[model samples]
Target: MSFKYIDVIKELINKIENSQLDVMEKVAQLCAETIIRGNILYFFGTGHSHMISEEPFYRAGGFVPVYPILETSLMLHDGAYKSTLMERVNGLSKILLEQSGATKDDIIFIISNSGRNNVTVEMAIEAKEKGLKVIAITSLIHSKSVKSRHPSGKKLYEIADYVIDNCGVVGDAAVQYENFEQKTGPTSTIAGVLIVNSVISRAVEIILDKGWKPPIFMSSNTDEGDEFNKKILQKYKSRIKLL
Candidate 1:
């Protein structure tokens, strides 16, 4: 019980280290192809899953072509309950997706740990309808355990062109203590981050192999880092909604 969280983290690492290489490489390949073709890569999620979309957007060592759809209504702020309600509201994603500038050559990633949310599912559907490729980051174990909230009775993984499982347990909590009903450690965030970064890094490596310089952001504190990132920032600020 004392080391349950540690055990949980170890399991998460093992999941990432083993059996995820094929999916990670495939995701990277798609991302690299998008970037090499000068197309955008968009990410979207609701609730806690939003953190994964936030991972690759204009951050240090991140790519400029990767954009995050940050719809305030679906985020946890001001009124979390309102955010929760909005996530289940149908047809909302269509309005957001229409303005995202995602094209047929681009890719859209929708994340939902349970793979059973109305917003994420609708976003993927809309993206696909627009001829964009859809990738999903979710826990298949969790999705299979629960019913999808979408009216179509389909999960995010079912709609996406690619699926990467976070391998997290249902409800996203993994730690169990003696005599306690609730689990403490929510492993989805950690697992999601790992999956996001690993895929992006692999994409970068693939780009490097081709001798084409990928626009990777550097920390602003360095002497020339600001100048280096400034060019990429200016180029993408107008294209990406939340730059």
Candidate 2:
């Protein structure tokens, strides 16, 4: 039996490594600058894309000031189908951004596989209006194939200051079987997590090169991890909600 899903994922990862390295480096530089300026990093997404937003928050080896802009209505747990409708709502992005307490000069990563939804597109616009840098992680193939769902006729990639293609295909599912009507094994989550973690790791290196220690979280499973995490959490608890 062949593992077609794994093979497909490996191919996509290779594409990202070869095609997205330059853009990832630029994003890392922005992250390093934002952290050095005492600004936080915000992440936002809807539906399955929200997983990318939550991936680095409070995660081991993740940055301390990372904030995931989570809205119950936009998540799968509350109502997966409803979240799909909610992400199309025009004004919700502004409300979420305001509630996030994000300020100017911060950086926000907006993940949307399609990149055509109103919420993610508007979120990028709103972040730009607030003087925050917007970095979008989306599938160029998927996004370009569809028209914008935003009133401005702009997709997340069009609005963001930087765009990192997840190198995923349209509809995201990568594995298909003989006689199957629909594909299985989505690639966005895996590709997105890799893209995000790689950039964050590079940002840490950039910070170290600049002579500043990046506030990284240690695994709570390890000895001395709790104490280390507590000190780091205390520093950003006021700024990062859900910390």
Candidate 3:
């Protein structure tokens, strides 16, 4: 049998539709609370998974005060293979957290499709130790099937305060075809994006329920949009390094 591109889209949409609303709501509530308390929301991941962290950071129509704890050593552009190795090294999470100045009131989002890597797990553990709330976006099936690389023998999902499973398979490739033993289409990225956006939408909803006008970025293209975002930038530029 042959699998077409729409097949992958259908599979991904099904996964998203079936994703646990409770877990996603928990993540959103945490983010909304962080925003209410005027604290930062932090995101961290490694390699391809790091792209998930960048999805909401400093973007138009995105929430303000969201920071991505990006480390070049673990990012692909610098060295893909090197990033993989760096994610396995213990104690790196602490450095990243310290540099970010994450606090108990902050919300930290850690993304790892597989959830087995040492650094992602370690970062969640470290974040909790620092009194920060951690939300993990990972594959429950994948993490359960794989052994943890961390010394604690715990996966990212186990360490985070809120665990929102991407509901993907172990290897994350969803489409299969005859004569191809290994699947071709990887669905984790799109599924993850959907989950993250859902969480953000829910967070905004919760904030509005509380009668607070949450600070969200506006598009840079429009005149009012530019003015609105510029003020937000001027207010947070000192606190946010990337702003």
Candidate 4:
């Protein structure tokens, strides 16, 4: 990568590390408590931030019962149930959630670099109205400038019960290039993963504090893989997100 891109990455990493650890702890506590109490977690991202949902969905060493809310269905190609205007990020989310099976006792994680998109704010409002706990992963600086697309004038930050900053720029670090501008950087994907891992680590701490082993999966290549993962899956079965 070019020096400019490297500089951008360093800045974002610094921002994330230098951000309020207090806020991260609080967010982790909320998520951990909710999950342990048997609430579902729904991860939603319309565009590039969709990558945020990938880890918690099917990967090992992740919580079991997480759901990925995307514009597409089981098939990658758009179908009858999928969004027609994939270009319109917000509208696509609305259509997808209208058909979702989310309930009142669930949790919603809205991931967006800008956090000002119409879809994210709409999902947050709808989820809150349905009595779901809302957690937002977005860039604070980026979202500060983008107003809510909804007529109610509420952004993701305003509606979320907990906010985790991805620490990426609002424009997504694409502006650093004089010519070949790219629209993403080290925040939504990198910081998003770090945030999830941190949440999992803290949650494990809490679980262990209760004198129970954390339900983390041992490496499949290990002898204890089957037993450890069995517990993890049994605990987080319904909370795992599917893309």
lDDT of 1 at 237: 81
Q: Rate the local accuracy (lDDT) of all candidates.
A: 0.88, 0.93, 0.85, 0.69
Each candidate's root-mean-square deviation in Å?
1.3, 0.9, 1.7, 4.0
Q: What value of lDDT does candidate 3 attain over all alpha carbons?
A: 0.85
Tell me the tens digit of each residue's lDDT in model 1 across 146-177. 88899999989899999888888888888876
Query: If the candidates were sorted by their TM-score against the true structure, best first, what order would they fall in?
Result: 2, 1, 3, 4
TM-score of each: 0.96, 0.98, 0.95, 0.78
Off by over 4 Å in 3: 1-3
lDDT, candidate 2, at 36: 91
lDDT of candidate 4 at residue 3, scale 0 to 100: 57
Lowest lDDT 10-residue stretch of candidate 3 = 1-10
How many clashes in candidate 1?
Answer: 0
Q: Which 10 residues in a row give candidate 1 its minimum summed lDDT?
A: 1-10
Runs with alpha carbons beyond 4 Å of true place in candidate 4: 1-3, 73-100, 174-186, 219-243
Model 2 TM-score relative to the real fold: 0.98
Q: Which structure is stronger by lDDT: 1 or 2?
A: 2
In candidate 4, clashing pairs total: 9
Question: TM-score for model 1?
Answer: 0.96
What's the C-alpha lDDT at position 225 in model 1? 91
Model 1, C-alpha of 5: deviation from truth (Å): 1.8
